[model samples]
Target: MSAQHAAPAAQPLRPARAPTGSGAIGFVGPVLAVLTIALGLVLVRDALAVAGVISGDGWVVTVLDAMNGQTRTGWALAGGIVAALLGLWLIVVALRRRRRKALWLRKAAGVGIRPRDVARLARVAADDVDGVLDAKVTAGRRNVNVDVRTTGDPYTRDRVREVVTARLAALAKPPKVSVRARPSSSTSGGMT
Candidate 1:
Protein backbone atom coordinates (compact mmCIF):
# COMPACT_ATOMS: atom_id res chain seq x y z
CA MET A 1 0.00 0.00 0.00
CA SER A 2 1.23 3.51 -0.81
CA ALA A 3 1.17 6.23 1.83
CA GLN A 4 -1.25 9.02 1.04
CA HIS A 5 -1.34 12.66 2.10
CA ALA A 6 -4.46 14.83 2.30
CA ALA A 7 -4.36 18.36 1.01
CA PRO A 8 -5.28 21.10 3.49
CA ALA A 9 -8.71 22.64 3.15
CA ALA A 10 -9.05 26.05 1.58
CA GLN A 11 -9.42 29.11 3.79
CA PRO A 12 -12.12 31.70 3.16
CA LEU A 13 -11.22 35.28 2.32
CA ARG A 14 -13.56 37.21 4.56
CA PRO A 15 -12.73 39.89 7.11
CA ALA A 16 -13.82 39.21 10.65
CA ARG A 17 -16.68 41.33 11.94
CA ALA A 18 -15.66 43.93 14.49
CA PRO A 19 -16.32 43.00 18.10
CA THR A 20 -18.80 45.02 20.18
CA GLY A 21 -17.47 46.68 23.33
CA SER A 22 -18.69 48.59 26.35
CA GLY A 23 -15.90 51.13 26.28
CA ALA A 24 -17.52 53.72 28.52
CA ILE A 25 -16.34 51.64 31.45
CA GLY A 26 -12.78 52.21 30.42
CA PHE A 27 -13.20 56.00 30.76
CA VAL A 28 -15.92 56.41 33.31
CA GLY A 29 -14.66 53.71 35.60
CA PRO A 30 -11.28 55.33 36.06
CA VAL A 31 -12.60 58.84 36.43
CA LEU A 32 -15.20 57.74 38.91
CA ALA A 33 -12.62 55.83 40.88
CA VAL A 34 -10.28 58.76 41.14
CA LEU A 35 -13.00 61.25 41.94
CA THR A 36 -14.50 58.97 44.56
CA ILE A 37 -11.16 58.40 46.24
CA ALA A 38 -10.16 62.05 46.20
CA LEU A 39 -13.51 63.28 47.41
CA GLY A 40 -13.63 60.63 50.11
CA LEU A 41 -10.17 61.56 51.25
CA VAL A 42 -11.11 65.23 51.39
CA LEU A 43 -14.22 64.46 53.42
CA VAL A 44 -12.26 62.32 55.87
CA ARG A 45 -9.61 64.95 56.22
CA ASP A 46 -12.17 67.63 56.88
CA ALA A 47 -13.87 65.48 59.52
CA LEU A 48 -10.59 64.74 61.24
CA ALA A 49 -9.57 68.38 61.22
CA VAL A 50 -12.92 69.55 62.58
CA ALA A 51 -12.71 67.01 65.42
CA GLY A 52 -9.29 68.44 66.46
CA VAL A 53 -7.59 65.20 65.45
CA ILE A 54 -5.44 67.22 63.04
CA SER A 55 -4.25 70.84 63.21
CA GLY A 56 -5.69 73.24 60.66
CA ASP A 57 -5.24 76.90 59.73
CA GLY A 58 -8.99 77.62 59.49
CA TRP A 59 -8.91 77.42 55.64
CA VAL A 60 -12.02 75.21 55.65
CA VAL A 61 -13.96 77.70 57.78
CA THR A 62 -12.91 80.53 55.48
CA VAL A 63 -14.04 78.57 52.40
CA LEU A 64 -17.33 77.67 54.07
CA ASP A 65 -18.05 81.26 55.13
CA ALA A 66 -17.30 82.56 51.66
CA MET A 67 -19.54 79.93 50.09
CA ASN A 68 -22.32 80.79 52.56
CA GLY A 69 -22.11 84.56 51.99
CA GLN A 70 -25.08 86.32 50.31
CA THR A 71 -22.97 87.66 47.38
CA ARG A 72 -21.80 84.13 46.48
CA THR A 73 -24.85 83.38 44.31
CA GLY A 74 -22.83 83.65 41.12
CA TRP A 75 -20.16 81.31 42.40
CA ALA A 76 -22.80 78.86 43.63
CA LEU A 77 -24.52 78.90 40.23
CA ALA A 78 -21.23 78.28 38.45
CA GLY A 79 -20.35 75.45 40.76
CA GLY A 80 -23.78 73.88 40.29
CA ILE A 81 -23.44 74.10 36.52
CA VAL A 82 -20.04 72.49 36.62
CA ALA A 83 -21.30 69.71 38.86
CA ALA A 84 -24.27 69.07 36.56
CA LEU A 85 -22.01 68.90 33.54
CA LEU A 86 -19.73 66.43 35.23
CA GLY A 87 -22.68 64.29 36.24
CA LEU A 88 -24.02 64.32 32.70
CA TRP A 89 -20.66 63.35 31.33
CA LEU A 90 -20.35 60.53 33.84
CA ILE A 91 -23.76 59.22 32.91
CA VAL A 92 -23.01 59.39 29.21
CA VAL A 93 -19.75 57.56 29.70
CA ALA A 94 -21.46 54.89 31.77
CA LEU A 95 -24.08 54.31 29.07
CA ARG A 96 -21.87 54.48 26.01
CA ARG A 97 -20.90 51.35 24.06
CA ARG A 98 -18.14 51.18 21.49
CA ARG A 99 -16.55 48.71 19.11
CA ARG A 100 -13.48 46.88 20.35
CA LYS A 101 -10.31 47.38 18.30
CA ALA A 102 -9.93 44.43 15.95
CA LEU A 103 -10.65 43.81 12.30
CA TRP A 104 -11.96 40.48 11.22
CA LEU A 105 -10.06 38.94 8.34
CA ARG A 106 -12.09 36.57 6.25
CA LYS A 107 -11.91 33.10 7.74
CA ALA A 108 -8.45 31.58 7.50
CA ALA A 109 -7.60 27.89 7.59
CA GLY A 110 -8.73 27.84 11.22
CA VAL A 111 -8.72 31.41 12.44
CA GLY A 112 -9.04 34.74 10.70
CA ILE A 113 -6.34 37.33 11.17
CA ARG A 114 -7.25 40.33 13.32
CA PRO A 115 -6.81 43.92 12.20
CA ARG A 116 -3.90 44.13 14.64
CA ASP A 117 -2.29 41.08 13.12
CA VAL A 118 -2.89 42.40 9.63
CA ALA A 119 -1.29 45.66 10.70
CA ARG A 120 1.74 43.78 11.95
CA LEU A 121 1.92 41.87 8.68
CA ALA A 122 1.73 45.10 6.70
CA ARG A 123 4.48 46.66 8.81
CA VAL A 124 6.64 43.62 8.23
CA ALA A 125 6.01 43.79 4.51
CA ALA A 126 6.89 47.46 4.45
CA ASP A 127 10.01 46.94 6.54
CA ASP A 128 11.25 44.33 4.06
CA VAL A 129 11.53 47.06 1.45
CA ASP A 130 14.94 48.66 0.94
CA GLY A 131 15.80 51.94 2.69
CA VAL A 132 12.93 51.63 5.15
CA LEU A 133 13.91 52.62 8.66
CA ASP A 134 10.52 52.02 10.23
CA ALA A 135 6.98 51.05 9.30
CA LYS A 136 3.56 51.33 10.88
CA VAL A 137 0.37 49.75 9.60
CA THR A 138 -3.24 50.53 10.43
CA ALA A 139 -5.30 47.76 8.90
CA GLY A 140 -9.06 47.63 8.53
CA ARG A 141 -11.41 45.41 6.64
CA ARG A 142 -11.94 48.07 4.01
CA ASN A 143 -8.44 49.53 3.85
CA VAL A 144 -4.80 49.10 4.81
CA ASN A 145 -2.67 52.17 5.45
CA VAL A 146 1.07 51.63 5.74
CA ASP A 147 3.29 54.51 6.79
CA VAL A 148 6.98 53.97 6.12
CA ARG A 149 9.80 56.02 7.57
CA THR A 150 13.03 55.98 5.60
CA THR A 151 16.61 57.02 6.30
CA GLY A 152 16.94 60.73 5.71
CA ASP A 153 19.66 60.20 3.14
CA PRO A 154 17.93 57.41 1.21
CA TYR A 155 14.27 57.59 0.19
CA THR A 156 12.33 54.36 -0.58
CA ARG A 157 8.76 55.49 -1.01
CA ASP A 158 8.09 53.79 -4.33
CA ARG A 159 9.78 50.56 -3.42
CA VAL A 160 7.82 50.43 -0.14
CA ARG A 161 4.57 50.96 -2.01
CA GLU A 162 5.23 48.18 -4.51
CA VAL A 163 6.34 45.68 -1.88
CA VAL A 164 3.41 46.41 0.41
CA THR A 165 0.97 46.22 -2.47
CA ALA A 166 2.34 42.85 -3.53
CA ARG A 167 2.33 41.48 -0.02
CA LEU A 168 -1.26 42.59 0.60
CA ALA A 169 -2.32 41.09 -2.70
CA ALA A 170 -0.92 37.72 -1.62
CA LEU A 171 -3.41 37.65 1.26
CA ALA A 172 -6.62 35.64 0.92
CA LYS A 173 -8.63 38.82 0.38
CA PRO A 174 -6.84 42.09 0.00
CA PRO A 175 -8.37 45.37 0.98
CA LYS A 176 -7.48 48.68 -0.63
CA VAL A 177 -3.89 49.43 0.45
CA SER A 178 -2.07 52.75 0.62
CA VAL A 179 1.59 53.29 1.47
CA ARG A 180 3.08 56.59 2.59
CA ALA A 181 6.79 57.25 3.10
CA ARG A 182 8.51 59.94 5.12
CA PRO A 183 11.80 60.59 6.83
CA SER A 184 12.19 58.84 10.16
CA SER A 185 11.12 60.84 13.21
CA SER A 186 13.10 61.11 16.47
CA THR A 187 12.09 57.55 17.39
CA SER A 188 14.53 54.76 16.46
CA GLY A 189 13.77 52.12 13.76
CA GLY A 190 11.02 49.55 14.42
CA MET A 191 7.80 48.21 12.93
CA THR A 192 4.41 49.04 14.47
Candidate 2:
Protein backbone atom coordinates (compact mmCIF):
# COMPACT_ATOMS: atom_id res chain seq x y z
CA MET A 1 0.00 0.00 0.00
CA SER A 2 3.05 2.36 0.47
CA ALA A 3 4.34 4.32 -2.58
CA GLN A 4 8.05 5.24 -3.15
CA HIS A 5 8.81 8.89 -3.93
CA ALA A 6 11.46 9.94 -6.48
CA ALA A 7 14.08 12.56 -5.64
CA PRO A 8 14.10 15.84 -7.51
CA ALA A 9 16.84 16.30 -10.14
CA ALA A 10 19.72 18.66 -9.41
CA GLN A 11 19.94 21.84 -11.45
CA PRO A 12 22.94 22.40 -13.71
CA LEU A 13 25.27 25.30 -12.96
CA ARG A 14 25.96 28.09 -15.42
CA PRO A 15 29.50 29.36 -16.02
CA ALA A 16 30.21 32.92 -14.94
CA ARG A 17 31.65 35.61 -17.19
CA ALA A 18 35.04 37.02 -16.13
CA PRO A 19 34.96 40.56 -14.82
CA THR A 20 36.82 43.44 -16.50
CA GLY A 21 37.98 46.82 -15.20
CA SER A 22 35.98 49.90 -16.25
CA GLY A 23 39.02 51.15 -18.23
CA ALA A 24 39.06 54.75 -19.48
CA ILE A 25 35.46 54.50 -20.64
CA GLY A 26 34.22 54.62 -17.07
CA PHE A 27 35.41 58.20 -16.54
CA VAL A 28 35.37 59.47 -20.13
CA GLY A 29 31.85 58.24 -20.91
CA PRO A 30 30.22 60.12 -18.08
CA VAL A 31 32.40 63.19 -18.61
CA LEU A 32 31.52 63.37 -22.31
CA ALA A 33 27.84 63.00 -21.47
CA VAL A 34 27.98 65.89 -19.02
CA LEU A 35 29.92 68.07 -21.45
CA THR A 36 27.38 67.36 -24.20
CA ILE A 37 24.52 68.29 -21.93
CA ALA A 38 26.20 71.54 -20.94
CA LEU A 39 26.86 72.45 -24.57
CA GLY A 40 23.26 71.68 -25.51
CA LEU A 41 22.01 73.85 -22.65
CA VAL A 42 24.23 76.73 -23.76
CA LEU A 43 22.95 76.48 -27.34
CA VAL A 44 19.35 76.38 -26.17
CA ARG A 45 19.91 79.43 -24.02
CA ASP A 46 21.50 81.30 -26.92
CA ALA A 47 18.56 80.38 -29.17
CA LEU A 48 16.10 81.58 -26.57
CA ALA A 49 17.97 84.89 -26.23
CA VAL A 50 17.91 85.40 -29.98
CA ALA A 51 14.16 84.82 -30.01
CA GLY A 52 13.74 87.41 -27.17
CA VAL A 53 12.69 84.69 -24.74
CA ILE A 54 15.58 85.64 -22.41
CA SER A 55 16.80 89.09 -21.33
CA GLY A 56 20.59 89.02 -22.01
CA ASP A 57 23.06 87.57 -24.52
CA GLY A 58 23.86 83.87 -23.86
CA TRP A 59 27.28 82.47 -22.82
CA VAL A 60 28.43 81.91 -26.42
CA VAL A 61 28.00 85.57 -27.36
CA THR A 62 29.68 86.75 -24.15
CA VAL A 63 32.67 84.43 -24.76
CA LEU A 64 33.01 85.50 -28.40
CA ASP A 65 32.91 89.18 -27.46
CA ALA A 66 35.58 88.69 -24.79
CA MET A 67 37.80 86.84 -27.27
CA ASN A 68 37.40 89.62 -29.86
CA GLY A 69 38.06 92.42 -27.38
CA GLN A 70 41.41 90.91 -26.29
CA THR A 71 44.50 90.52 -28.50
CA ARG A 72 44.77 86.86 -27.40
CA THR A 73 45.81 84.92 -30.48
CA GLY A 74 48.42 83.06 -28.47
CA TRP A 75 45.86 82.03 -25.86
CA ALA A 76 43.45 80.83 -28.53
CA LEU A 77 46.17 78.78 -30.25
CA ALA A 78 47.22 77.20 -26.96
CA GLY A 79 43.62 76.33 -26.12
CA GLY A 80 43.14 74.72 -29.53
CA ILE A 81 46.27 72.64 -29.10
CA VAL A 82 45.17 71.51 -25.66
CA ALA A 83 41.74 70.56 -26.97
CA ALA A 84 43.24 68.59 -29.85
CA LEU A 85 45.54 66.72 -27.49
CA LEU A 86 42.60 65.93 -25.23
CA GLY A 87 40.61 64.56 -28.15
CA LEU A 88 43.50 62.31 -29.13
CA TRP A 89 43.84 61.11 -25.55
CA LEU A 90 40.15 60.30 -25.42
CA ILE A 91 40.41 58.26 -28.60
CA VAL A 92 43.32 56.28 -27.20
CA VAL A 93 41.47 55.62 -23.96
CA ALA A 94 38.37 54.47 -25.81
CA LEU A 95 40.40 51.91 -27.75
CA ARG A 96 42.34 50.59 -24.74
CA ARG A 97 41.15 47.35 -23.09
CA ARG A 98 40.16 47.14 -19.44
CA ARG A 99 42.42 45.28 -17.02
CA ARG A 100 41.01 42.46 -14.87
CA LYS A 101 40.28 43.22 -11.21
CA ALA A 102 39.97 39.71 -9.88
CA LEU A 103 40.88 36.14 -10.68
CA TRP A 104 38.31 33.34 -10.75
CA LEU A 105 38.43 30.50 -8.28
CA ARG A 106 38.64 27.01 -9.73
CA LYS A 107 35.41 24.99 -9.96
CA ALA A 108 33.51 27.72 -8.12
CA ALA A 109 30.49 29.35 -9.74
CA GLY A 110 30.40 33.15 -9.76
CA VAL A 111 33.21 33.38 -7.21
CA GLY A 112 36.17 35.74 -7.58
CA ILE A 113 39.41 36.35 -5.69
CA ARG A 114 41.09 39.74 -5.55
CA PRO A 115 44.81 40.15 -6.14
CA ARG A 116 45.33 41.35 -2.53
CA ASP A 117 43.80 38.16 -1.22
CA VAL A 118 45.86 36.12 -3.62
CA ALA A 119 48.99 37.81 -2.33
CA ARG A 120 48.00 37.09 1.22
CA LEU A 121 47.40 33.46 0.34
CA ALA A 122 50.75 33.20 -1.36
CA ARG A 123 52.45 34.80 1.63
CA VAL A 124 50.86 32.25 3.89
CA ALA A 125 52.01 29.41 1.66
CA ALA A 126 55.50 30.85 1.53
CA ASP A 127 55.63 31.22 5.30
CA ASP A 128 54.81 27.54 5.61
CA VAL A 129 58.00 26.57 3.79
CA ASP A 130 60.90 25.39 5.98
CA GLY A 131 63.33 28.15 7.15
CA VAL A 132 61.19 31.05 5.89
CA LEU A 133 61.33 33.81 8.52
CA ASP A 134 59.04 36.31 6.80
CA ALA A 135 57.31 36.61 3.46
CA LYS A 136 55.93 39.46 1.38
CA VAL A 137 53.80 38.83 -1.64
CA THR A 138 52.32 40.97 -4.43
CA ALA A 139 49.89 39.60 -6.96
CA GLY A 140 48.65 41.07 -10.22
CA ARG A 141 46.25 39.76 -12.81
CA ARG A 142 48.99 37.70 -14.47
CA ASN A 143 51.85 37.57 -11.98
CA VAL A 144 52.60 36.87 -8.33
CA ASN A 145 55.85 38.06 -6.79
CA VAL A 146 57.11 36.79 -3.43
CA ASP A 147 59.97 38.05 -1.29
CA VAL A 148 61.03 35.74 1.45
CA ARG A 149 63.49 36.36 4.26
CA THR A 150 64.88 33.08 5.42
CA THR A 151 66.58 31.66 8.52
CA GLY A 152 69.67 31.20 6.35
CA ASP A 153 71.16 28.60 4.02
CA PRO A 154 69.00 25.55 3.05
CA TYR A 155 65.93 27.67 2.10
CA THR A 156 65.83 28.52 -1.61
CA ARG A 157 63.71 30.73 -3.88
CA ASP A 158 62.72 27.66 -5.85
CA ARG A 159 61.20 26.10 -2.75
CA VAL A 160 59.13 29.21 -2.08
CA ARG A 161 58.04 29.45 -5.72
CA GLU A 162 56.98 25.83 -5.74
CA VAL A 163 54.98 26.10 -2.54
CA VAL A 164 53.28 29.33 -3.53
CA THR A 165 52.45 27.98 -6.98
CA ALA A 166 50.97 24.83 -5.51
CA ARG A 167 48.84 26.81 -3.06
CA LEU A 168 47.49 28.95 -5.92
CA ALA A 169 46.69 25.93 -8.10
CA ALA A 170 43.03 26.34 -7.13
CA LEU A 171 42.75 29.53 -9.15
CA ALA A 172 41.13 29.19 -12.57
CA LYS A 173 44.17 30.81 -14.19
CA PRO A 174 46.97 30.82 -11.68
CA PRO A 175 49.32 33.75 -12.18
CA LYS A 176 53.01 33.25 -12.96
CA VAL A 177 54.77 32.97 -9.62
CA SER A 178 58.18 34.45 -8.86
CA VAL A 179 60.10 34.21 -5.59
CA ARG A 180 63.21 35.92 -4.24
CA ALA A 181 64.71 34.40 -1.09
CA ARG A 182 67.11 36.29 1.09
CA PRO A 183 68.94 35.36 4.26
CA SER A 184 67.76 37.02 7.46
CA SER A 185 69.65 40.18 8.42
CA SER A 186 70.93 38.60 11.62
CA THR A 187 72.49 35.72 9.71
CA SER A 188 73.52 37.59 6.53
CA GLY A 189 75.21 40.58 8.30
CA GLY A 190 73.11 43.19 6.43
CA MET A 191 69.78 44.92 6.87
CA THR A 192 66.97 43.15 4.99
Q: Summarize candidate 2's per-residue lDDT along 113-147 as a digit string, tens digits.
A: 88999999999999899889899998997999998
In lDDT terms, how accurate is model 1?
Answer: 0.73
Candidate 2 local accuracy as lDDT?
A: 0.86
Q: Which portions of model 2 show Cα errors greater than 4 Å?
A: 1-11, 65-74, 186-192
- The lDDT of each candidate is 0.73, 0.86
After TM-score superposition, the amount by which residue 160's alpha carbon in candidate 2 deviates from its true location, in angstroms, is: 1.1
| The best candidate in terms of lDDT | 2
For candidate 1, lDDT tens digit of each residue in 92-178? 878876755544344344345566787788799888887888888888866888877787534477677677777666455677888
| Stretches of model 1 off by over 4 angstroms after superposition | 1-22, 30-72, 108-115, 130-145, 149-159, 166-176, 182-192
Which candidate has the highest TM-score of all? 2
Q: How high is each candidate's TM-score?
A: 0.50, 0.79
